[model samples]
Target chain A: MRNRMNQRQECRLTVGTLTDAMRAQSLLSASAIRSEIVGADGVRERREGCGYALTFSCLQEGQVRRILREAGLRRF
Target chain B: MIYLDHAATSFPKPREVLSEMTRCMRFYGGNPGRGSHSLSLAAAEKVYACRRAVAELVGSRHPERLAFTLNATSAINTVVKGLLRTGDHVLISDMEHNAVLRPVARLAREGRITYTVFPTMLLEEGRSPARITARLARLVRPNTRMLICAHASNVCSASLPLEVLGEFCRKRGILFVVDAAQSLGHLPIDVEEMKIDALCAPGHKGLLGPQGSGFFLLGEGVEAETLIEGGSGYHSLEEEMPAEMPERYEAGTLPTPAIAGLLAGIGEVRRMGIDAIHAHECRLIAHLARRLSYLPEVTLYAPQYQGSVLSFGIAGRSAEEVGLALNRMGFCVRAGFHCSALGHRTLGTDATGTVRVSVGYCTTEAQIDALADAAQRLCRRT
Candidate 1:
């Protein structure tokens, strides 16, 4: 249960548009860093014009950012 | 079967197109720009090559300026909906396909923009490019923001003088957009030389690729609002669509396999040469026109401006009836309005659309003979 709770601790990465968010999600998934598209209801303030966010585990935030940077993605 | 509806979509795509699409599906069935893996990279590379090929075909300076869409309609919609603002005006030709007409018309209906259909006489035979340019200049209004016209009519196959129009638009600071659905691979188009602002074309038609593959190439200093906004694989933390070339317009997962096929199709077109293909289709049209002209019962529409397509009507038979009779004899021809009510209106055949026989790269003299013979017999029976 504790491990499950830890895995559920999510962190969001906001992108400029929906296309970039999807791209970031694809990169994260390929790197084995699980992520989900958070709806505008969940990340309204953080959402860019695309109105979505890639939510991954807090533990994977560093790695996700690194991967996105390596892929030449700009994060908000 | 003799497939003469190349205007609708080219049948029997080049062998390389099929092979390349199959190879991509089997070997690298990965989402492009989605990840950094080898499969993703490979898919991205193939998609990039497709863009590059399209850019090269149109003489575009940058491959990144091209955005792949589902078809020419979608590409045109991206420009029409994204470029024009409320109260702006546009100019189009009377010979435009619905692909160009409907979107612009809808905007006008919604009271966002107003448009005028330039008279067809501008494109009529014997009108020099200079005269057409001057006539178009007269049609432009102070609010005229853009001019959109098809490179060639899908119904009557009337080739528009795009270079002259492009030059006129450039001088007037009016954006020039071309719907190259019928002319992309059948005729040579130089976006740079023509000063074209944006060009839209379908890969499935003249390019000899599968359906669901089309693109829009943008010229320098031209930008439009994003029509469909979603994940673009970059600038992931912004609340707005990215201010980029293709990523600004291309959203969601692209059709990868179809794009792969389109890349090969472009390659084959390059190898065969567009001029050769155009010459062959023109020859076929010329033969068909000559034979049909001898038929007293057939009224050929715009036969003098024959390009790759020929439209005609029988005296006693509807376009549909003649099309059906020809189909029964195993010749595929498109009947009815050919999705261009505006074109039919110009041809005075809006009520009874003309039968459109469009030839392709693979269409032969023998096929043209067969079509002519079938039409002659049908005319006699009627």
Candidate 2:
């Protein structure tokens, strides 16, 4: 169990908007992948707005990207 | 006062809606999508949920396709000014509100576009859909790029057959845009089924949200230029607006509290079932029309299609006088053109307009009865 947990790594896919990040999170969850939206703090600077991304397991990165691209999200 | 001017704005918003707004302002009054803090995320989630709800209401497969706007008027303006290119020709119904009329007219006057008015009034003359389509077939120029119309008349209850119009636009490769100002929550709308490229509606009237809430639902493959450009809470480094939907159009801070309230309002609407609401309101309209029809002075407009609204005028009395008299009787209704000059012109009541009694989900039969009695009393007094 410890070795498996150590082997797993975290991967992030930046989706640009908080809504899209949440949407990606939903799609991943439906596909049995758990993801978290992180990095949304930039308003204190005010010069640059915040950016968000979906953080999930490295094993699910490829599948997540495919799903998001198919859904016409984060196409760039 | 018994509020019947639902076509203008619904009064006595659902309790859930009110509480949701209050909760938003009280608990998590933070700018949505601006930060990762719990409050901002909470607000963002609320806004996203509202977007999903509205998209579902409009039959959109992608929630991202819907964008929050000031009202149906702003949404209509966004689509008209953003979607149509210079030299494009367009068609609108004879019964359109000024929301559709003014924008189209301004574009025409600026030499950016040309337009024609299709005769929806011909439906009153017993014209079939085929006849209506054929007449529109003649009006469509080579440059005709769009057909914009109201889903239902604001001043009356007449609704255009969206399926037929959608089919007509599809065959001709014209964008089908609808202003669902009066019909969004009152009637069922399926953007995909109707081939509607874009739908604009207010959150206030049928959805029972507060005044500053509205949305635009875009069908698949619909594209438009950004009407306004500012902070989209994303891609701040780039000059051009983001290429994706919602964020692409929403260039400023959204009304989080209003959107949260709108979400609750839509949920309530879903719970009550739109069909049941429509049936209840129509029954009331029918009852009132029946009573008012007995009065020789009352003239009902589009009597066959009183969906959730009924428009009538009293003989030898202006709509204003009748409306004021109804108000004095503790009944609230709308008089004059109701911001629908084209509709009034189509009905040939442009001179004095008509008294428009629009209903909502909460409107009661007793109110309708009292309004009918008020109408009768108005005739007797005159």
Top candidate (TM-score): 2
Candidate 2 collision pairs? none
lDDT of 2 by residue, B220-287 (tens): 78899988999877667779998778888998899999999999999989999999999998998888
Show the lowest summed lDDT stretch of 10 residues, model 1 chain B: B119-128
True contacts kept of each: 0.06, 0.47
Global CA lDDT of candidate 2, please?
A: 0.85
Q: For each prediction, how big is the interface RMSD?
A: 8.3, 3.7
Native contacts recovered by candidate 2, as a share? 0.47
Name the best candidate (by DockQ): 2
What is the TM-score (0 to 1) of candidate 2?
0.94
- Looking at model 2 chain A, which ten-residue stretch has the lowest summed lDDT? A1-10
lDDT of each: 0.84, 0.85
